[model samples]
Target: MDTLAIVILNYNGQSFLAKFLPTVLANAEGYPVYVADSASTDGSVAFVRTHFSAVRLIELPRNEGYAGGYNMALEHIQTHYGGATYYVLPNSDIEVTPGWLDPVMKLLDANPQIAACQPKILSYAERELFEHAGAAGGYVDWLGYVFCRGRVFATFESDQGQYNDNQEIFWATGACLFIRAELFHRVGGFDASFFAHMEEIDLCWRLKRLGYEIWACGQSTVYHVGGGTLHKSNPHKTYLNYRNSLFMLYKNWPADGWLWGKFLLRLILDGVSSLLFLKVGQWRDVLAIIRAHFSFYGRLPHLHRQRKALLKQQKAEVPLYPHSIVWDYFIKGKKTFEAIVETSEK
Candidate 1:
């Protein structure tokens, strides 16, 4: 079995596969590459089969979304390639550079403590800027608000080589995440219920709780065309992001007094976000936020069960940004990551 396997999850991304597959295959020298198709009707599987015949294709029966699709695909990988050390789960809409996997894979190989990591992700269209999904690395605020070293909320920082150092982070962007194969299953893979957005953060949070490090390896890099599957402007993406963020906090945060206070504060922040959406006349987005909260409330029982199961297995402390990222980015006008870090230091 190959020590590493690069698996791209695809839905209806025929164009992306046709365009980016060559770069992926070229950079994936000495590693097995697989495409896990989520039963796309757009002839995505057939195209891959016809053109990239060497690339292994696993066709699922239906579209289970990213979370479920990866879980299912990884399970297949585990069963078949039990000796494989690492799995790279990249989005279909990514373009990799030469030697892109070396730095991150080498880091993981040397450090068993690190369960997962991602390379520096830049924007494909705008090469100078960090990508929204994962700029340098991902981190979360005290209230479960996720942002990256080069991205804070909607504001993205340009690539100035500020985050070049490989460092431990709260989460690795799923856009091009490289994870230790065995540990991925051990921590109980991504929450299938989430189905999509914020699932990577939840998985990383779980890994962190289990005393495993997640990191961003800046020595290697890739470009991502964000919003390939679900565009940022779509209210459905907003809804899933909002609902899943709450679900993540509920399932992972400690059951101590700290939980309720943070949850309430996050709710208030979410309300503020709703108001901002209203100001922009994004009425559907506002309704999406409201619906997200209701969905969170409805799933409390399931989330509680998950929390109980997780807590029973691990009691490690997961790191979160000491300050509120929302306040820092919006109120304090800290746009770039360097600015935020500098402000936090003061």
Candidate 2:
């Protein structure tokens, strides 16, 4: 019997905890549940302790964002519980379904090559539509853009059994990631510097680069209420997504003559996006992009060192979408993921 521990990292989300934690507890009857609070002053820790006493609690000294908070919490789990075979890191806002863990667990157990996997994530609000964070499974395009099988840019596909087949994916949703315990530590876990967004891709890409597979088990499903912490419109979330995307590409993409060109292209795209925001008078978003660029520039030295460290590890040629997602979506008017994939195949 494989030992699995489900851990949810919370920060000032007492209400989310109040609503969703019960569903998680009800569904996860056999496995132990834990609530890792990131020093939230909103009494999240107290609420968990008061209502859901059986759910183990870890009180982090300070809020260090998702990457750092999870690292600390998982480390504690490894130390305290003797080492669970699997770790399921679900967001505070996720509503996991009954039997959700079985398929993903079976997939991981059946394939030693698979390091991480996620369930088919639908939207909590719509229930039938796929969510934005991760619709089905994620893939990295030629331009380092991450899109899901059920979503493309802002266009989300309805739950019409389109992505029902279990398949290999480029990345798993961090909203509810299932990872092997040993492999998580072997790769040094999530990069704490990522702070929040795109950290899952950074971790998954490392696993992918190291020749380990990430998977999506279609048999299981979860509903995600995204932007629980930072709304999509928040400039800070924009900064993290844009900047960490650059960071991920910088650290993981093979260092070659063409890598610089790709970076340049991405920069131009970022600038174009800022102008679009400017046209709409989203001055804050424009500043966020500028700030993201400058922040990346400031971290170049650090990223260079990190890149060299990654090179020291054994690597394999990771699979990529091999097409320009931006061109296919914006120029060719391919809105759905199925259309993009069909055109790529042709």
TM-score of candidate 2 on Cα atoms, chains taken together:
0.98
- TM-score of decoy 1: 0.97
Error of 1 at 11 (Å): 0.4
Model 1 per-residue lDDT tens digits across residues 1-346: 6799899999999999999999999889868899999989999988999999879889888888999999999888877766378899889999999999889878998999999999999999999999899899998877788888998877888888888899999999999999998888887788999999989999999988888899999899999998999999999999999999999999888656799889899999899889999999999999999999999999999899989999888859876788987788888999877788888899
Candidate 1 C-alpha error for residue 203, in Å: 0.7
RMSD of 2: 1.1
User: 280 in model 2: Cα distance from truth in Å?
Assistant: 1.1
Cα RMSD to the true fold for all candidates: 1.2, 1.1
Superposed Cα deviation of residue 298, candidate 2 (Å): 0.7
Q: Give per-residue lDDT, candidate 2, residue 141.
A: 91
Model 2, span 31-72: residue lDDT tens: 999999999999898888889988999999998999999999
Query: Candidate 2: which stretches are off by over 4 Å?
Result: none
